[model samples]
Target chain A: MTVLATPQPTISASETGTETVPLLEVENLSTEFATHAGTLRAVDGVSMSMTAGEVLGIVGESGSGKSVTALSILGLIRAPGRVSGGSIRFQNHGELLTKSASEMRKIRGDMISMIFQEPMTSLNPVFRVGWQIAEALRLHRNMSKAEATERAAELLERVGIASPRKRVSEFPHQLSGGMRQRVMIAMAMACAPKLLLADEPTTALDVTVQAQILDLMVQLKEEDGAAVMLITHDLGVIAEMAQKVAVMYAGVVMEEADVGELFDEPLHPYTQGLLNSIPRGHSRGSALKAIPGIVPNLLHLPTGCRFRDRCPAAHAPCGKAEPPLQRMPDSARKVRCWLHHPEPPK
Target chain B: MRNYLLKRLAQTIPVLFGISVLVFSMLHLAPGDPADLLLGPDATPEAVAELRSDMGLDRPLVVQYGAWAGRILQGDFGRSVVLNRAVLPEILKRFKNTAILTAGALVFAVIFGIGIGILAAVFHQTAFDSTAMLVALAGLSMPTFFTGIAGILIFAMGMQVLPSSGMYPARGGDFFDLLRHLVMPAITLGAVSAAILARMTRSAMLEVIQQDFIRTARAKGVSERGVVWVHALRNAAITIVTVLGMQIGYLLGGSVITEAVFSWPGLGQMMVRAIQARDYPTVQGGVLLIAMSFVFINLAVDLIYAWIDPRIRYS
Candidate 1:
C-alpha cells in the first residue's frame, strides 16, 4: 500500500520491455543467516520489479545468493536464515513481509507458487505423484479428493506427459528425472497462481531434457498468463526465456537490464566476464575466459565492491566502497559499478 | 507384497533349524549331571547309575540328540526333569505371562518413546529437547532390576497402592489386580528400550525433516504440524520401525532381571529356576521358543518395512 506511484508505461522507441503493469515489487530486501561463526548476509538490499506475464531471470554463480533472493520472495527461508528486512508487494496482497506465517501460507501455493531445482528429491517419495499434485489444490482451493485427482491428471497432460491418468497414481521413483520435473511443474500450477518462482528448474536434467523443460515452462506460463521469476546461472536460458535479466554477485544484484542488452553490451565487468566464459564452437581453439578469483565468503565479505578483487578493471576507487544500483542514461537498465557511479556509496 | 512375505517366511526355516540345534546342544553340552543334581551329593553310586540309566542319560550322545530332536519335531518338548510335567505346556503357561508384560511394555514404550522423540526432534536444540534427551540417557544407563526394586518400594511397599510382585495378588484377583501388578514391571522393563527407541526416532526424524521433500511439503502450504507429522514422520518411520523391530526380538527374550525382581511367573524366571537344577528339557524348550519368536518378529518387521517403502517392495 505504501508503494510509490508507478509511472505511466510510456511507449518508447528503445523497447525497455517493462511497460506492462507491475505484478511483484520487492524493495530493499535483506536476508541473513545467523551461523556459529557470524551473521552471513546471503541476500542484501535486493530490489526488483516484475510486470505481469514477464519472465525475469536472476542469474548468478553458485554462492551469489540468487537462490536466496527467490526464497526470500516466497517466504520460504527456514530456521537460522530469516528475512531480516524487506517489503514484498505481490499484486494486491499488500506487504508480504508483514503477513503472519499463516497469512503467508494462504498466499503460497495459491497466488504464488514455487518449483525447486531437484525434482528427484522435491516430491515426497511415499506419496503418489498425483497425490502430491492434488495436495496444493486441496490446500488452497479446498477441492474434493476426486475433483483434485481429475485436475491433477489434466495438469499432467497439460505439461505434455502422455496418458496422464495412468501416470497420476505412480510414485515419483517410478518416473524418469524429466517426468518428475514435469510433475513438479504440475504441482506448482495446481492452483494456477499469478506468479511462479522457479529456482534452477532445469539445472539437474539432461541437456535435451533441459531445453524441453525450459520450453514447457515458458509455454505453460504463456497459456496460464502467469509471470515467472527464473533463478539460474545459465545465460543461455535467460537469453531464450527472460525479457529482463538481473546479474547478481555476492548477494547483491550487480546489474539489471533487458536480456538482449545484457548479452550484447554487459554494463558490469562481472556480467562481461560471465558472457565471455561461455565456451562456444567458434572459440574452441582459444582458451575460455573464466572470471578470476573465487566468491568471497559471505561471513567475511570485503569492505568495498564484492567483485573488485576479481574485476579486471578494478581501480583505487573500487576498493574504497560499494556502488549503488543506478539507472543507465539511455534505457530502463541498471548497473552497480564504480565506472557507472563514480561517486560510490555517497 | 505377498511374494515378499512368503519369501521372508521361507527364509526362516534354516535359521530356525540352526537356532534349535544351538539351543539343544548348549544345554546338553554344559558340565553337569542331571542325576547328581536330582539326587543329593550323598546319593550312592548304585542309585545315581540307576537314575541315569532310568532317565536314558546313559545313552550315547548322538542317540540322545537324535531322540531329543525327533520328539521336538513331533511338537513334543518331553518332560521337565524336576517338575515331572510336560515341558511344552509349562513353557506355554510361562510364555503367556511374559507376553502380558511385553505387551504392556510395548504400549508404554510406543506412547512415551515415540511421542517424546518426535516432539524433541521438532523442537530440537531447545530446552525441552535437551531435557528429554538427558532423561532418555538416564533411562538407558539405569538397569531394570534396580528400577523394579525402587518401583516396588515406592509404589507397592511405601505407597501400598500396587502389588509388589507376581501376575496377580496371592488370593484370586481380577483383571484390575493383574494390571496393578503389571504396571511397575512394564515400566521397568520398557525403560531401556524406550530410551533406545527415542534416540533412534529423534535422529531419524531429524534426518527426514532436512530432506527436500519436507521443503516441498512446506511450499505446498501444508500446516507446520502437517509438514512434520505427515511428511517427516512418514519418512522417518522405516528407520524407527527397524529399531523397534530389533527391540521386539530382545523383548521376547524377556526382561529377565525385571521379571525376577518383580517375582513374575514368566519364562525368564522359569528358565532361571530350571537352570539352577539342571532341568534340561525346560531350559531348552523355553529358549527355543524365544529364539523362534525372535525370527518371526524379524520377519514381521521386514514386512512392515516393505509396506512403508515402495522401493523395497517393488524391487
Candidate 2:
C-alpha cells in the first residue's frame, strides 16, 4: 500500500477547482415504488459526490437503501420502480443514466461494473466459468471468441484462481463459494471499468474469505485506479477499504465525512447508534449494543426525518421538517441532524 | 448418470405390468361382443358361437387373460380378430401415424410453449405479458375439439392456404405432403399444451426471477435480456420441462378429438374405430401401447431431472 501525506485527500494537487466537478454527482435522487399501502421511497433524496480514485462506503442496515443506491447508479432498477426526481451527473463520462435501453446496455458492463452479494446464485450454473467471464469482454470490448476466452483464463489467474486454464472449463456448481466470488471479481474486472460497485461482495463468504476478498479489491482498486462504491452493513470493512463514508438511514444519508473523521466522530444519532451496535472485543461478556427499535418502513416514513422515530435525541422540531446536510463548524464533515445544527431564527 | 438411467429402466417394469393388467381386464369387461360385431346382425346364432369359440372368446375370463399374458410375455400382442392377423403388425402400422402426429405436435408444442413462456416471463405484468397470458387462458378454456374446428375453418376453409387434415396424400409416400397433412392436427393437439406450458413458464419464471441470484445478475450490469434468458429462464428449467414431459405423454396417449376432426390416422382414431367394431384385440393393443408410452415418458422425465438440475445426483 502506498501512503500519501494524508490518507484522506481534501482535494488532490494538479487539479485546480476540481472540487467543483465531482467525478460522479448524484443530486436529490429519489426512487419510489408504487405499492398497496403507499408509494415507497426506497432511495429518498440521497445526494453524494465521489472523485476519481475514491472508495466511498455507504453503510446501512438491510432496508436502509444502501444497495438500492448502488443499483440506481447502474440504472438497474426495474419496473414498479420510478426514479421520480433527481439528476445523476458524471463529469467526463457522458451521463449518469440513459433512459434509452440500448445506451444503458452499453454502459452497464463496460463503463460501470458491479459485483453482487451472493457469488453462488449470481453465476449461471449451466455455463462454464470462462464463458461467463468472456461474455462481458465479448459484448463490451468487441473481442473475438478466442481472444475473450484467452483473456478470461488470464483474468481468473489474475484474481488468484489456481490452475485457471483448467478451472475455466468447469461449471459454477463445481466451484466453492469463495472461488465463485473470485470468478465474480474476474468477470467484473474483465473490461477494466472505471467504477466498480461492490455490494456486499464478501457477505456470503466465511470470515477468512471475506478478508481475502476485501484485500484483493483494495489492491485492484489501487492498481486500476478505479473508484469503488462499497455498500455493506459491516463498519469494519468500511474502515479498512473506504476513503469516504456515508451513513444512510431509511433511504436518506445521515452523515458524510472522510472515513477517519467519521469513524473517530460520528455526529448523527443514527450513525452513533450504528457504530455502537457493532460487537466490540471489550463487550464480550455484556450484551451487544443494539439500537432500539426497527427501521421504519419506507412506505410510511416519518414526515420530518426518517430516523427521528428511533432516535433518542429527537425533539419536537424534528417532526416538522427534514434536516439538510450542513457542514460542521470545526471540520469539513457534513451531518444531517437538527441536534447538531439548529434551524436559523425565523 | 448411467446409474440413474439403469435405476429408471428397472423401475419401469412394475409400472408396465400394472398397466397391462388393468388394460387387459378393462377390455375384457367392456360392454361389447367382438364376435357379434364381426359376424354382423344377420348372422345365425351357431355361426356367431363358432366364431367366438374360434377366437377363444368362449373361454373363461381368467383363462383368456392368462393366454393373452403368456403371449405378451413372448413378445406377441396376439391377433386382431377383426384384421384376422397379428395384432402387433396392425397396431404398429397405425402407430406410425400416431408417432408422426405426436412428434409433430410435440415439436410444435415445445417450441411455441417455451417461446411464449419466455416472452411472457421476460415481459412480466406488461401489456405483452398480459396479452400473451390472456391468450393462453383462452387456449386452455376452449376445448380441443373447438380449437380443431376453428383451426380447420380459419386455415382450411377461409384461407384456402393448406391441406386441412390426414396423414398423407392419396398418391402417398411424399415427406413434404405428409408434413403438410400433419399441420392442422398437430396445431390442434399442441394448442392446449402450449397454453398450459405458458402459464407454467410464467409462474416458474416469476419464482426464479425473485431469487437472489437474479438480483445479482442485474447488478452485475448484465443486460435485461441476459438476466431473463441466461439467469432466470435456465433456473426455471426443471418446472418447465416437467410440464412439457406431461404434455408429451398426453399427446402420445391420445389426440382423439383432433384426430377425428382433422381425420389424422392416430392411435386415438384407431381405438375409437376398434371400440365401435368391438375389435377387442385392437383395443387392448392400443391401450397397452398408450400405457407403455406413458410409463416410458415418465421414466424419461425422471432421468432428465438429474441432467437439468445438477443438484440432484443419483446415489
Candidate 3:
C-alpha cells in the first residue's frame, strides 16, 4: 500500500525538556508459560518506550502477547507463567522487574494502574462500586473512611454518573456495563498514577458507550498527565486516540511508528494488510483485502521470520533468518522486515 | 426484612402439618399396640380391652389423628404411654441435650471444615491439599456410628482420655467434665459432615478465586490475603452457607445413631426408646420438633445470604 506520510504534532519528552526521561522503558521483555505441550513464549523480546502523558497503542489480533506484556509490567504473572527476561524501568521507581511482590503492590495502584477488558466481571459483585473505589484511596492515600467515601462519590460524579450519592451505595450488579467501565476508570484515576494500562477497557461495551468511555479515558489522561499503554485489536481506537502505534503479530512487534505515519505509510506487509482490511469510504462497494493465514501458535512458531508464511513478499532470504527491529533512516519509526533491511551478510 | 421473616414463618405451617401427618400415620401403621405395651404381657384380655378404649386406641385412624391434631393445636402433645409423662416436657428436656450436642458438633465442623478448605484451596496441588482431601474422602466414606465406636476405642479405651458414653458424670461433674464427655461424640458425629462441608468450601473457594473480580482486587493493590479472604471468601460464602444449612439439618436427624452409640440422653435416644416402647406421643413430638428446627435453620441461611451479598434481595 503506497501512501503519503501525514505530518502530526510530536509529543515527545525530549521536546519538552532536554534531560527528561521517558515515563516507562520496557526493554527486550520476554514472558513464557510452561505448558505440557512445551515452553510457550507468549511474549518474545518486545521493546517499547513511552513518555509522560503520551498514548502508546499496541494493536494485535487475539493471542498476540499484548496482554502478557501489560501483566509483566505490573509483575502480575502468576504460577507457570513468568517474565523470563526483561527490564521494566519506571521514571520514579527503578527497574520494576526486580522489585519484590510487596514493593510491586505499593506501586501497582499508586504509580501505575490497570483497567481490564470485561467491566461486567471486573468489579467485586458483593461490594458497592463506591466502596471499591474508596478502598484504593484508603489503601494508598491513608484517607479516613468518611473522606475516602466522599471522594469516591465525587469521582463517580466526575465520571458522569448521575445521583452519585445513591449510586455509591449500590452494588456492581446494579450498574450497566458502560457505567461499570466508568467506575473502573474512576478507580484507576483515583490516585492519579503516572502510567495507566487499559487492556481492552472498551471492548465489552456497546458501540455508543465505547466512544464515551474512550472520551472519558482521554480526559482522565489529560487531567492526570499519565502515560497510557492502551492494548486493543481495534485499529479505529488506535487511529483515534494513540499518538504512537505498535503492530504486533505472533508475539513480536512488526512495526512501531507515530500513529499518523503508521496509518499513512504502514511499512510491514502485515501492517499494510491490516490497513487495507478496514472498509474505507472509497472501498465501500469492493471486497476488503484480508491478511492470509491465522496467527501462528506460540508453542510451535515458524522457524525464521514469524510472518513469512503469511507475507506476500516472502522469498528465500525471508526464510533464512529473522529480521531485527531496525530504525528507519532520519526517522523515529521502526520496522522488522527484510524488505526494508536488505543487505548481504558481512 | 420483617415481611420476609413473616412470609417465611407462614410458609412453615403447611410443612409442619405435613410432617405431623406423616409421623402420626407411620407410627399407627407400624405393628405394635401402645395399649398392649402399657398393660404388659400378663394382663388379661378384658384389661387390655378396657385400657385400649380408655386411651382412645379403639377409635378409627381418622378419629385418633383428629383428636391428636386438636390437642396439638391447644399446645398439648398428650402423654407418653410407656414413660407416663407429658410428651412436651419430656421432648423439651431431651431437645436441650440434643441442641447442645448439635451446636458443639456444628462449631467443630465449621471451624475445622472451613479452615482446612481454605488451606487446601490456597495451597492447591500441594501435598497438604492432597492429604487433606484424602482425609476428607475417608471421613465421608465412614459411617457416623462406625466412627463413634472407633472414637470410643481410641480415645476412651486405648488412650483412656475420655468417657466411652454419657453426657456427664452421674455424681454431678463440673462443666469441664461434661465437655470431656461431649468431645468424643461431637467429633464422631461431626467428622463426616465436616468432610462434606470441607469439600464444598474447597470447590466454592476455587471457583471464586478464579473469578475476574479477584484479579481486579489484586490489581487494585489489595494484599493477597485480602484478595483471598475478603474478596473471594465472601463470594464463596453463598455456597458455603447453603451447604452448612443442609448439613445442619442432616446432623440433627442423623444424630440418632451417634446419640444411641454414646447414650447421650438426646432426642435421638429418646425417640428410639419411645419407638421401642410404643410411646407414640413422644416419637411424634420429637420428629415434629426436629422438622420445624430444620425449616427455621434454612430460613436463617437464606437471611445470611442477604447479609453476605447485599445483591440478594429476599423480596
Candidate 4:
C-alpha cells in the first residue's frame, strides 16, 4: 500500500485561488448500448469534475461501467452505443468543446490525450511507433514532417526511453509491452494536452512495472500541468495516486469523496465490500471476504439500488425504488445507498 | 519471413506438378480419344489410325505422358491435334481475354465491397446500412448466369448502355474496344464476388470497431471517419485481405456461364469447347493455366501480408 500519508505540498490550495475553474466537468452522464436482448445502460447518471493538474481515480469491479464513464466524457462510445444524456464541459485554456466531429478531431489529441489499457493492440502494428506519435503532432499542429520526427525523438526521450533516435525507426512489434505503453504515453504527452485520460494504463503490466509507469505518469503530469482521469480496478493504484476517488458498482456511482475520506470512512456498502475484498497478507490462508453475489446484469438491472442484491445492508425499502446519489450531512462524501440514512424522503 | 517465403516457393513446385499430373490423367482417362474425335465416327479405320499415330495417341500411355510432360517442362503444352498448332499459344490467346475480365471484375469487387462494407458497419443498423446489406444478400442469392442475363437485359437490351456479348470486336481493332466489350460480363462476375466480400468486410469491421484501440482513438478525439478508417479498418485489414484474396481466386477462376452466354472468349469458354471436342491438349492447357494463376494469386497475397501488417516477415 503506497497511500500517501500527507498531501503533496506542491498543489497547496491557497497557492492557486479557487477562481481557477476545473478543466473538465462531467454532469449527470448516462450512456446506453443497444443489444439484441434490450438496451443496456452501461453508464448511468455519473458526474465528476477535475481541476487542472489534479488526479482523479475511478475504481470499480469489472462491468461497473467505470471505463464507460471515462469513454462517455470523450464521446468515444461507438455504434450500438450512444450517450443518452449528459454534458462533458472541458475548459482547456478557456476554450469550449461543443463542436462537430471534425472540429472535435482538431482538439482531441491536440488539447486532450488518452492512453489505453492494452499497449500491445493500441499501437498500430503496420506503422512505426514514432510515426504514430509524430502523426498526433502533425495532425494537431502544422509542423513539417522533419520537425515532427525530431519532436517525436524528444518525446521518446522525455518518456525515459533509451536511444530515442534509433527506436523511432522501429515498428511497434519490435518493442516490448512496457516500452510500447511508454510510447503511447509519450504520444499522449506530445502536444502537452491539458487533460490526460488514462484508462487502466497499467493493468496489463506486471506489478513492479505498474508502479514504475504510474510514478512516471505522476511525474510527467506534474511537469505538464495536466489533469488526469485514471480509470482502473486497482485500489492500491488509486490509494497511491488519486486525489479524489469515485467508486462505481453495476453501472452507477456508489460512493465518491477525497481519497483520505473514502478510505477512512467508506459509507456505501458496495465500496466497503470492494475494500474488504482486497486480500490482506494475514488473511491469505483464510477465505477472503468476497462480495456475496456477482454484479447484476446491466440490461436487466434490479428495480431499486443495483447493488441491493449483493449488498449485505439492504432493507425492505431498497426493493421499492432506485436510490439517488445524495450527500452526507456531516461530510463531503456522496453515497448511493439507503443504509447511510434512515429512509428516502417521499 | 524471407525464409518462410522461400520455403513456400520451394513447396509450390510439387503442388503444381501434382495438379498437372492429376489434370492430365483425368482428361486422358475420359471417354473418346482426341484423335478419334478429330477423325469423327464416319471416318475409315486407316484414316483414324493415321490420325492416332500423327497425334501420338498410338504410343504407350507412359511414353505419351512422358513426352507431353517433357514438352510442358519445356514450356510447350503440346500441339492441339485438331487445330494443328501448339496448344500453349492457342490457350494463351483466350487466357488473355479471361485475364482482362478477371482484372476488371476484381477491381470492381474490391472497391465496391470495401466501400459498402465500411459504410454498413459504421452506420450499423441504420436504414442505409440495412439497405446495403440487403443488396449484398440479394447479390449472394443470384447465381452468376442469372446475374449476367439480368445485366445484359438491363444494360444491353433494355437500357442500350453497352454491348451484350463477346470479348472484342470481330475485326479486333484497338485494346480499348476489347475492354469496352468486357465491362458487362466483368460487372456480372464482380457482383457475385462483391456480395460475399461485403458481408465479410462488415463482419470484420464490426469485430474491429469493438477493440480498445478504436475506443482509444475515439477518446483521443479522432473523428468518426478517422476512428473507423485509421483505427478499426486498419485492424480489420488482415481479415479483409484474406476474404479479398479468396474472392480474387473466385473471380480469376472465370464465370463459365457468363463467359459462354456473353460469347466472351475466355479460358472457360475455350475449355468448354476443348472438352466438347475431346481435345486433350487444349483441355490440359486451360486447366493448367487456371491452376497456375490461382497459385500465383495466393503467392501474391502472401507477399502482401508483410506489407499490410509489420508483424508478418518473410525471414
Chain A TM-scores, all candidates?
0.93, 0.93, 0.94, 0.92
Candidate 1 per-residue lDDT, tens place, B1-315, comes to 799888888999999989978987876678767788789899999999999998778998778778888999998998998899999999999999998999888878888899899999999999999999999999999988888889899998899988888887788799998998899899999988899998889999999999998888888788899898988998899998999998877776757887899998998999999988888889999999888888888888898898888778877
The clash count of every prediction, one per candidate, is: 0, 0, 0, 5
Task: Please write out the lDDT profile of model 1 over residues A1-346, one tens digit for every residue.
Answer: 1122224335341354334447899999999999999999999899999887789999999989888988888889988999999789987788999889999999888888889999999999988899899989999989999999999999999999999999998888999999999999999988888899999999999999999999999899977778999999998899999999999999999999999888989989999999999988899999999998899998888878888889999887787878889898878999999888746644
Task: Name the DockQ score for candidate 4.
Answer: 0.48
How does each model score on lDDT?
Answer: 0.89, 0.83, 0.89, 0.83
True contacts kept of each: 0.60, 0.42, 0.68, 0.65
Our tally of clashes for model 2 stands at 0
Residue pairs with clashing backbones, model 3: none
Candidate 4 clashing pairs, residues 3+ apart or interchain? B1-B313, B1-B314, B1-B315, B2-B314, B2-B315
Q: What's the distance in Å from true for residue B167, model 1?
A: 1.9
- Residue ranges of candidate 1 with Cα displaced over 4 Å: A1-21, A342-346, B33-67
lDDT of 1 at B211: 96
TM-score of chain B of each: 0.93, 0.90, 0.91, 0.90
Better of 1 and 2 by DockQ: 1
Model 1: residue B154 alpha-carbon error in angstroms:
1.7
Model 3, range B1-315, lDDT digits (tens) per residue?
667667777887888788878978876677767677677899999999999899788999889889988898887988887777889999999999999889888988999898899889999989999999999999999999899999998989999989998888888788898899999888888998899889999999999988988888888899999988899999999999999999899889989999989999999999988878778888888888898798889888988887887776532
Best by DockQ: 3
Categorize the docking of model 4.
acceptable
Per-residue C-alpha lDDT of model 3 across residues A1-346, encoded as one tens digit per residue: 1122113335444655522787899999999999999999999999999888899999998999999999999888987899999799998788999998899999988889999999999999998898999999998999999999999999999999999999998889889999999999999988989899999999999999999999999988887778899999999999999999998988899999999999989999999998988889988999999998999988877777899899998877788888899899989999998888857122
